[model samples]
Target: MTVTIGFVGAGGIAEWQHFDIVEARDDVEVAGICDVNQAAASEAAERFDATAYTDHEKLYDGEDLDAVFVCIPPFAHGPAEIAAAERGIDLFVEKPLALSVDRAREIHQAIDAADVLAGVGYDWRYSRGVERAQELLDGRTVATIEGRWWGGVPGDDGHWWREFEKSGGQIVEQATHVYDTVRLLAGDVEAVSGAGSHRLVDAVDFADSTSVTMEHESGAISHVSTTCAAEDHDAHLEVVADGATLRITEEEITGTVDGEDIEESFDVNPYAVEVDAFVEAVAAGDPSPIRSTYDDAFDTFALTMAANEALDADGRVQPAAIDDGTDAGEADQ
Candidate 1:
């Protein structure tokens, strides 16, 4: 069965990752493309032979979509997501769910009430290397978890990401992949403490270099550091467990398990894997195949937001609590 898909944003990661992946799949049809930029939306629409619209509401109203990929920036998140959820359309959202925690919470509530299947773009969770790291660390005590995303300032779609208010800084905006992968390998973070410096980037007041320490609920300690100062790009997560030490990067997993050396290279494309997973789940009428569901990714958002708070306060901050909406509704009743 062909899963009909709509795109909420048509540039940068949307085109580079999602557009190409879905367009290559025979069982997936690109039904509509919507972006604030008319030229971008129209170009993508023309290429895919899909309809183009400037507003997501119009796309949602006009097209019979099985799922919509909400790829807008962090600040432009709420409206598209809420509208889609209200219409009972499944969603695949790109991460750092929103610039504000309250906005993310609201979107989460909408998805829950509508009973829609939603996936977040924490594509690293689907990496073969990450899976290998999980297998190696299973049934073992994880001691220290370390992750890093060292890279240059991103300028893909536009300069919107360079602004703090729009992008939520480097930790929340770009390195969130590291944070999500850390949570996947270690556990949910109970508290976040971090420090950052904005001396490097003049364009934004937020940090250009950041280091976050996360205390997992399981009593494990994890540290993730990010910097947009370097010219080279590197991202990876390393975990030290009872009997194994595993390092997972986008391309491979390498380290020692049971005092034996191990190395595994992955040729897999995580973007394709994640997209395929979402499409399959949409077709199967089950979201279990998606590794990063909306609520699950929200936890990662809360963690990063806590890190942001920690940076400003110079103290540990617990992640903002989120309810599944069941108890809150009953309380109101």
Candidate 2:
């Protein structure tokens, strides 16, 4: 089946993840491209041989697309998702689904009410090593999960990513992958406390470096840190589940346990496997493991937001739940 696809943003993600997977797949087709800038849309449309539009509504309304990928910045997400879900279009929205918890829940309701297949692009959840680690760590008592994502901050390159309202600082903009992956390995975060600073980057007003401690309802302790200060970019996710430790460093994983030395060294390319999974889910009507379901993504996003809140005030933020009402507790069973 040919799955028609529309996109709300045609910047980095479109050039990278969306184009690579959607265009490569025999079952997927690029139906329309939308961007606030006509030039960008046109360039992407020509490159992909798809139609482009300056306004998202035209792309959304004119085409009978199967799914829409909302790769717009965080601030643009709420409006984009509202339109897609209302149209009953299956959606593949990128991570940090929204800048705030309230907007996240609103999108959740719209998608659920529309009875659409909705998923968020928490891309790291699709990594091969990440999947292996989750299997090893599942049904085990996880002790600690530590992660660090450091790189030079993205400057204003005519993108909304430079704006705080759009990106929510580096924490929400970039570190959300680490945040979401930690939750996937550990569990739902309960309490958050920490500190952050704007000592490095001149682009954003808020902190470009943040460190936080989270206590999960599973009693697993996690240490999360992110910064745009390092000279070279790096990513790492390490989980200590009981006596076993599974780690993936800035570029790869090393070490072994139980005769399985699961290691995969790789370049940090922008393309992702999660996009394929989302598209496949749209085709098959079956949900993927890391669907970034409304509740799951919001919990991680709220935890990240609350971590920032606690850091700014030097206090503990508790009951990290969803509902756009600041009711930070676990989701309903």
Candidate 3:
């Protein structure tokens, strides 16, 4: 059986993460595409010989697609997602879920009230290095971990990402991947302390860069410093346990045991893996390996929002004050 998939956005990451992978899969077919920008949707349709539309209702109501990929902006997610859920179409949406908790809750409610599968584009979790890191750290006495992701703003996307109000700054729009990765590898986040500056963009609600400190419940420490001000930018994760260390870069993961070094290149393009996983999940009736499921996705949003709140509070954003069910509270007694 083949899975008919409709793609809703046709841009950089959409192309990078979905188009390339789905095009190569025999079990998946690009059935339709919808973009408010008809030309963009037509471009994707032309490549797959599928239908294109400016209205998503055409895809949901008219087409025979079994699932939909919602790759629109953070703020543009809820309606498309609810549409898919109402139609019982499995969905794969891009990360950070939404710009606010209320919106995420709405989408999550739609998803939970339906009989469909859903996944988010947290591609990092599908990466081989990140998976290996998760595997190696299991049952070990973890001490400290930190992740950093820095890169330039998307001038390629017409600079739409520079607006903090739209993108939710670096935390919601970008480092969300890192935030989710750390929590998956470390533990439940207890509190968030944030610091950010408008060093690069002017009159934008989003920061050009930010630094966040995360306190986890498992007694492990984690810190994150994210910036988009540099050219040779990507991401890296470092973890320490019993004085030993494990570090994962974008393409490589390194582990040192007793001061002996071990490292290798990992081949997974988390984007490709995520697309494949979503299709398989829809077919087999399961969630994915790298899902930013609304539950976890909302947690990521909450943590980052709390971090932003912390920065707004002059770094006094204590754990007790954050109302988002993300921070650590009195663990016992």
Q: Which structure among the candidates has the greatest lDDT?
A: 1
Candidate 3, residues 9-74: lDDT per residue as tens digits?
887577765888888999988888999998999998999999988889888887887889999887
- Alpha-carbon local distance difference test for all models: 0.88, 0.78, 0.78
Could you give the candidate ranking by TM-score, starting with the highest? 1, 3, 2
Clashes of each: 0, 3, 3
Q: Report the Cα lDDT for residue 333, model 1.
A: 7
The residue-level lDDT of candidate 2 at 282 comes to: 87
Q: What is the lDDT of candidate 3?
A: 0.78
lDDT against true structure, model 1: 0.88
Per-residue CA lDDT of candidate 1, range 212-296, in tens?
A: 8888988899999998888899998888999898888978988989989998898999999999999999999999899999999
TM-score of each: 0.95, 0.91, 0.91
Candidate 1 residue-wise lDDT at 207: 84
Which pairs of residues clash in candidate 2, taking residues 3 or more apart in a chain or in different chains?
Answer: 319-328, 321-328, 321-329
List, residue by residue over 205-244, the lDDT tens digit for candidate 2. Answer: 6777889888888889998898887899888888877657
- lDDT value, residue 321 of candidate 3: 23
